[model samples]
Target: MTSYVEALEHLNQTVELHEKWDLEKISQIIARPNATNIQIVGTNGKGTTALFLQKILCAHGFNVGLFTSPHLVNVTERIRYNANCISANEFGKVYMELRDIFDEKQLSYFEKLMVVAAEFFCRHPVDFVIWEAGLGGRLDATTAIKNDIVLFTPIAKDHSEYLGDTLEQIAYEKFFVSQYAKKVYSSPQSQIVQNFMQKQAEIYCKEIFFIPQVSNFYIAETGTVFDIDNQKITIPMLGKHYAQNAALAWNAAQQTLKQKFSVEAGKQALENAAWPGRLQIVQRNADKYVFCCAHNMHSLQSDLEVLKVLREKDILSKNTGVIFAVTRNRPAQQHLQMISKIFPNIVVTAANAQHPIPQELQQQNYAIANEFGDAVRVLQKQGIHDYLIIGSIYLVGEAYKYLELEVRS
Candidate 1:
């Protein structure tokens, strides 16, 4: 029997994506015909949206399995049942069972994880399986399975290399997975992109519903409240963007389970749902750190809006400093410029070799650190207790590791 450590070693040897393979054939090996699957795809908010939907369904007395990517602290975080991640022992057992098939199929790292999730869910049958795409919906491994319901978070221009350079191209790529879905829904997007998507849906003879933004909302220091269908829904997480995700989840849940929808259950689910590393606050000694995964330009704008609102409401200090980092593929200059407009005290750093400290960022008046831990040290020496750490998801993961915090559902 392969241990979890050995399984991870095998997975680490594989690449993130492969140019060619038969994902459908491999996925069908563990396909559960009765298991309803919801596939979510977007540039940002896929993980959070899936989480919100999972919690909502589970609260309504349905067993749900959630599969997401880029685990913050542990690989087990990718395969979750209801709200808890798959235990390491179970993960090792499943991985060992699939090892021979994995080698035969030449599966990529993501494909192996997807296979594990599919098999795990099939064995422990759930009412629904929420599959969050690892990349663009068209070629994403999650697409290999039949998506009973396909949902799209706000589409943006990130991952242009694989998806597309233009917004229309990106939207079309994400819409591909919806071709066979029983129902399709999306959050509000740019007018141009929405028009493009609508035209595409019409050509395919599939109707796509676009969810409107949450209108009635109140924000306090603790959380935000939104009035949905005259039902006061309160979520513990801050920001209107989170409210939008909750609203979308509520609408989707109602649509998916028309007669089964329970207001009390939905409210409880929304209140309990928590997404870490997005405006996540960590306390270490006397210092406080705020971590957010706003890697791309679109997400950065959304996160900054939340920060601005927090400052205006006096929930967050206006003098809060920020530690910024970026992957090499991202435009460092543009990100730094955007952050500088709102935050004067900025410290730049990198999480790993893939994300090198940009020369442009270093040339600025901002302080630089070799990595996330070093950045925290730099802030500590300067006596800056309240600061925001924003950038790549990898950076946020590093922050969690440095703070010795474990990520949970």
Candidate 2:
């Protein structure tokens, strides 16, 4: 038997799935007998929404399985029961066992992971399964499952290479997740998304529920507070945008369970929810640094809004420093313009070989560091009050490792 690390490395070398694969073949390999209730979430906040649903369902005494993608630290994070990450040994054992099946019928990296997770869920016997779309919904690997519920979060320009260039085009691709959904719940979206969703819902014959925007949310020095469905709760995470994300999660949970989920339980889970690499704080010496995997324009804009709000409340000082990096596929100029608009004093760094820091941005930014470690060192030496590390997940992952923060699940 090959070692788990070897198996993981081998899988990583395989190509990613473009769209859906053979569902019958996948089902034959991985039994999903207990996957009667499935929810497919798209775009930003999908992971958080899935986590919220998992907590609420578990609180209601239901066994829940959660499947998310592009894990920040470990592959085990892709699959979970309740709030716990699947054990490494268990993941290794499952992968090693499933390898023979993959060898028998060639599968992509994501395809293998999806099948492994499905098989694991069947063995675990969860009452409900929350599956996050890896990319666009229409042909995503997760679409192989016939979902009972479909959820959509705020959609913005992302994966332009594959999805599309315009918002309408992108929304069209994401709307594909609604095909298998019996009922749909979506956060209030733009006219483009709403119109597209309406058209899709009519064709698919699925009821659509729109979560209202959070009216009143305030951030304190320690955390944030907001009201959802008349239930006021506090979450340890920062940003008013997070309050909206939590509200969306709460509404989705209520809609799915057809019962009033405990506000206190949801609040507690939100407090305990450690979505690392998303506005996560890492400390080095006396400086407090925040790392976020904000790759696209929408997320970067949201993060900037939160930062502005934090600055106004005096939670973050103006002297904060920023270290930015992104993937080559992303629109680097647009992201840099947004960051420059929000943060004047910034330092740019290039990590991945494919996506080097653009010369234009490097010229605009006061400092440019070729390496991640050197970027951190240069930022620290500048005596900035607070630090923000933004861009690709790879950048945040590398920063997490350098800080000696827990990386493995």
Candidate 3:
């Protein structure tokens, strides 16, 4: 029996997307398994939204399986059953059980894991399984499965290379995944994006429930608290967008009950649910640091706005220091300019994800580091008490690992 670690390493090393990307054939391995699958797609918000749904449904006493991408720490973080990680031992068991099928399908790194998740669900028998698309919905691997519901998070122009240049084009690619979805719940979006989604609902003949949001929510350094209708909910984390994600989950949960959703589970699930990397806090001695995965221009805007509010509430300080690194494709100058508007001096470092520091970023009044730790050391030496880091989730994940910080859920 190859160990789980060994098997995962082998699979990851062998599978390549350019060689094979047939999700339909890979999905067939677990196609006959008894499960009600829901696929959520968007440029942002899918991971948090999926996590919210998982916590809600699980709190409702239903067995739930959740699949999300770009794990901040362990790869096993990508798959969960009833709020518990599918253990490496079990993961290896399932992987070996279907190892031959995966080799035959020639699955990609992502597709390989998704299939494993599907198999894990098949073995455990869950009430519902939520799959978050790794990329654009219509063409992504998750759409290969026959899903019961599809949720659309707020779409944006992040992955311009594969999805499209404009928001409309990206919106179309993501919305089309729900063509066969019996029900669709979407978060509030830009008017143009909302209109496009409504058009998709009309074309697919599926009902679209636009989830209502509360903008003036509460955010404390400890966490954020807000309500969904009559349900008073609190998350042990930061970010205003999280409140919106929780609301989207409430709407989706209502669909499963076949009646008005229960606020009963809302309190417990919202309070306990752990979403890593988005406004995550790390405390080293007396110094406190906040790390958020605000990768793109739109996400940066949302993150900076939240920071401003936190500053108002004393959750953050005017003297806060931010460390940032962006993926190579996005306009580095614009991203750096946005940061400069909110933060005067920041640390710039090469991300473990391997995106080089942009020249424009170097031109700014920023400190450079050979690695993320060096950047943090620069702050630590200066006796900086507050550190706020934001950029790609990959960058955040790298920092998470380098710091050996254990993040909650």
Candidate with the greatest lDDT versus the true structure? 1
Sort by lDDT, best first: 1, 3, 2
TM-scores, one per candidate: 0.94, 0.91, 0.92
Provide the lowest-lDDT 10-residue window in model 2: 16-25
- Runs of candidate 3 with Cα error greater than 4 angstroms are 14-20, 30-33, 259-261, 353-365
Global lDDT of each candidate: 0.83, 0.74, 0.80
What residue pairs are clashing in model 2?
none
Candidate 3 lDDT over 1-409, as tens digits, reads 3568777776668634533456567656655347778998887788888998988888888888998897877778888998688788888888887778767777777887888888788888788899999988776888888688888888989778777888899999888877778888888999999998888788888788988776558887668877767666778767778888888887788777756456777678878887888887777777777888888877788888888887787766777787877777877678778877777668888767447777777777678986778887888887778888877777788788877887567
**Candidate with better TM-score, 1 vs 3:** 1
Candidate 2: C-alpha lDDT: 0.74
Pairs with backbone N, CA or C atoms under 3 Å apart (clashes), candidate 1: none
Stretches off by above 4 angstroms in model 1 are 21-30, 359-365
Candidate 2 lDDT tens digits, 1-409: 2466866876777765554355556555655546655655556777766766676677777788888887766788888987688887788888888887888877877778888888888888688888888787766767778677788888877888788988888888888778777777888788878888888788877778888888778877666677876777766567776677777777777665564566667666666655677766666677787877878877787777877777787666777888888776677777877877767677788855546876666767368888678887887787775878888887887677667688532
Instruction: Identify the runs in model 2 with alpha carbons over 4 angstroms from their true place.
Output: 17-30, 352-366, 407-409
Candidate 2 local lDDT, residue 333: 74
Better of 1 and 2 by lDDT: 1
Rate residue 136 of model 1 by lDDT: 83
